[model samples]
Target: MVIPETFFAERTSLLKASEIRELLKWVAEGGIISFGGGMPSPATFPRQQIIEAITEGISEHGDKLLQYGTTQGLNELRSELKNFMEWRGINVSNVDDIVVLSGSQQGLDMFGKVFIDEGDVVLMELPAYLAAINAFKLYDPEFVGLKMDDDGIIMDSLESVLKELKSKHKKVKFLYTVPTCQNPTGVTLSVERRKRLLELASEYDFLIIEDDPYSLILYEPIDVAPLKSMDGEGRVTYLSTFSKILSPGLRLGWVLADARLIKKFVLAKQGMDLCTSPLLQYIAYVALKRKVIQENLSKIRGLYKTKRDKMLEALETYFPEGCKWTTPIGGLFIFAWVPERVNTKELIQDCIKKYGIAYVPGQSFFVDESGTNTMRLNFSYPAMDEIEEGIKRLGQAIKERL
Candidate 1:
């Protein structure tokens, strides 16, 4: 018996399949060089360390590891996370303000569940993280896209948008930002802008959701700090994942927020998954306690930086003039804008079938559906040779279209 469309909730209609994930399916068939998903390099995974950590955790705390954990997560893991955040310059005075998540994706969903109401105004960068736009879209919020310069979100543009929304009597709930080494674009918000952002949040009375998964993966030293660290009013809700720094397969992430907000997130989380796996939490606890994650960062940064440089070189050598891309300080992606007449969405299938390469068309990343001439290329997952060849092929595809 087939279920009718009416059987599904109306909210389900808003859900769209991720282009990057769909591209992965094609890439799995072999032959295609994919610059689609923002996946960490498998070479960077601390396999030996993980094995040791898992063995030690089970031998010492098998009972706890195997059993169910609290909705707020394992206390040991939270304690470790508090220390980790402190090292990153985020002062967590209490572990109660931390809540472990399955991934940062979960934290995004939780934000939608707890805060978003029908038509609530949610601010996002013009070309934001596609996953985030998809996650928040489920809750039916009015997404206002903000402009950005090389330094990340433009303060003037944000202030103007805020004033316009205020004039229209819109209830501005919060601004969701990837802030450091932002996805798709790979631009970090500068320290000056970070301070101004917090000031604007205060002046306009809105919350800031700082999704900071790529801060630790920088290739060059930047003076920027996490927005959460500068947020003195407790208005910033920070979300980060072990996906980049450690392993995405473990699927461990955490939220650093006010205690009251953490309590609410805990309640929402209980209705979602009772708790993130105790086994996984314990593994992360071991990894953090042993400083495995810390020790592995230099290797990850060095390797990805090389890949990033290779991709940039290929883009320069192969990509036709009139095409432009961001020179990221550190991140897995490089977002490019082709000639105005080239709609990447329309060219993607041809690129895959003919060029034997895949990339996420940038349109989906734009909340306002405006980036038709753009594409986001992932440099972390593909090998050095693949990076060069893939950029070459992508260049040819764009050039032919031009």
Candidate 2:
């Protein structure tokens, strides 16, 4: 049978396939200790509570859950998220401003569909989330990278990019960021930077899509509010998820925006799935209603804190002199930089073969430049003992390479 070329959208040709997923497939078959993926430890998930919540939902809601539901998602689920955000000092007056997504990744995809068009400009941190890069790339959006440092993406660099785009008479659809505990870097943007970012967004008249799935897992008390909290004009779209906190299996998350924009997202979501799984939403609602999410988050925060500390400590003790990494206040991963001569892409394979340990090269995270001498080490999944050994293996791999 012959196939038509028009069966696929022309925009799909723009995206390179996901490198992380390819690496993970190889790593999973290697039978080695791994720290590659930024996956939370399933050991920390509230399996029992999830079971209870699902049972309760089935008992209480029955076929209502098994049937089609509103495109805006369950009203009670949206209400629960609104209250949760309110506790964080973020105010969303209309409950309709929120839309339920399968997870924050789906939220990114939906936003890409609604806001991004052919040749539209989308700004992102230099080394940003790969999934966001992949999701947005498929829409043929032009990506501009803002400079980054230990304190997160530099404000001046962001301003320069925005100014340049403005001068060229270009309209940037949105800037994507994981402000707190950013992926691949694990650096939190300071409160001052966060406010400055919002100011720049206002000046440029673009949107900031703040993807913050890890903020709630902070190890220390955070004084900085979300960009959405400071946004009075409804320019920032906030996305959060239950995946990192309660259960990834649930695939439940929420998107907060202006009611008008949310209406667009609702239409986009309707085309994607009509609605998020009713059964999953009902179970999540029950979990929140019963305080199961809170309980699970507490447990996860404590466990990941210890894991993060152990990995940081190992970096200090085991890595060679001049090696550097960020000491994140909270998060599952840390980015390590070796001397410029050392290529982490090659080193990771050596570490896997020689020491039965693995980590992800930072090259895959960047949009323009490939970071060959850097690596991102995930600390959440490995136990304390395993972390020590993994670090030792990684360090040995580096030393041998040198």
| Residue-wise C-alpha lDDT for candidate 1, range 1-402, written one tens digit per residue | 899999999999999888888998987898889999988999999898888877887888899888888999999999999999999999998999999999989999999999999899999998999999999999999999999878999999999999999999886999999998899899999898999999999999999999999999999998988998888999999999999988999999999999889889999999999999998888788789988899999999999999999999999999999999999999899999999999999999899989999999999999989999999999999999999999998999998998
Model 1: residues with Cα > 4 Å off, grouped in runs: none
Compare the candidates by lDDT and give the number of the best one. Answer: 1
**Steric clashes per prediction:** 0, 0
In order, the Cα lDDT scores of the candidates are: 0.93, 0.85
What TM-score would every model get versus the actual structure? 0.99, 0.95
Model 1 reaches what TM-score against the true structure?
0.99
**What lDDT tens digits, residue by residue, belong to model 2 across residues 130-211?**
8998898888888888889988889988888888888999998899999999987888999999989888888888899999
* C-alpha RMSD in Å of predicted model 2 compared with the true structure: 1.9
Candidate 2 versus the native: TM-score? 0.95
RMSD score of candidate 1 (Å):
0.8
